[model samples]
Target: MIKKFLVFSALLCSAVFCNAQNAQLEAAVGKLTRLMVTPDSLGLDSILLDNLSYGHSNGGLQSKPQFMRSLLTGASDFVEIDLTDKQVVIQNKIALVRHTLSAKTNDKNIPGKVKLYILLVWSNEKTGWKLLARQAVKVPEK
Candidate 1:
């Protein structure tokens, strides 16, 4: 009976820990979307790892420096960003985040709308949760 109780208690504690972690991760994802729309170099730099791999739906890829440069220079301009259908999974110190990105953009002064499926990888580092990688693919239309 004592053994069973201990096992149950451990499981309960784990569940609560997982829920807390999920909430923190969700907030981090939201922060990322906001920074994407309104480029904040410091805020972004803090959340991204030095070797970030950012991939666009067009098969374009950017390293951390390249990504930061584009956002800072308004080259990869984002007028508005909306994310929906978000899901997050955590394993050890790594997290996999999936969501639908619906955004209105003015890239190179040309207005455009994009709906894409996005996958983001985050690692829980010494500072906090930092984005390690991201990939985007176009969402199919009906």
Candidate 2:
């Protein structure tokens, strides 16, 4: 029937839309990682929401300005960052992403490595996807 055909088409369209949104979110995350490692101030400012809440495993939290300052001032220097096992779910204008982050950093010139489970919340804006929040928990060594 026409009704059934219409229903099928609607479902197919929704699935395709979701796939495209997921790809966009993944690309946003990738760009964020690159910007973090390289400390691109302009790129960072564009990609992060003004009210960003960035939480670390040590129970520390930073606002958007603080986070940007840390990167700009060499307080947080990432030599390399690798993200794995990423899963992204999109709901309306928000996307939730979970991933494993393994990174080498030089914080205040003290070199260190970290492995953490990260959760990132992105808000889809008119310009693009902006990082709204992020939390990281240390992953135990196996």
lDDT of each: 0.91, 0.94
TM-scores for all predictions: 0.93, 0.94
Tens-digit lDDT track of model 2 for 1-142? 9999999999999999888888888889989999889887899999999999999999999999999999989898999999999888888999999999999999999999999999999999998899999999999877
Query: Model 1: per-residue lDDT, tens digit, 19-61?
Result: 8888888888878888888888898898899999999999999
Superposed Cα deviation of residue 26, candidate 2 (Å): 0.6
Q: Give me the candidate number with maximum lDDT.
A: 2
Q: Output the TM-score of candidate 2.
A: 0.94
For model 1, the stretches where C-alpha displacement exceeds 4 angstroms are: none
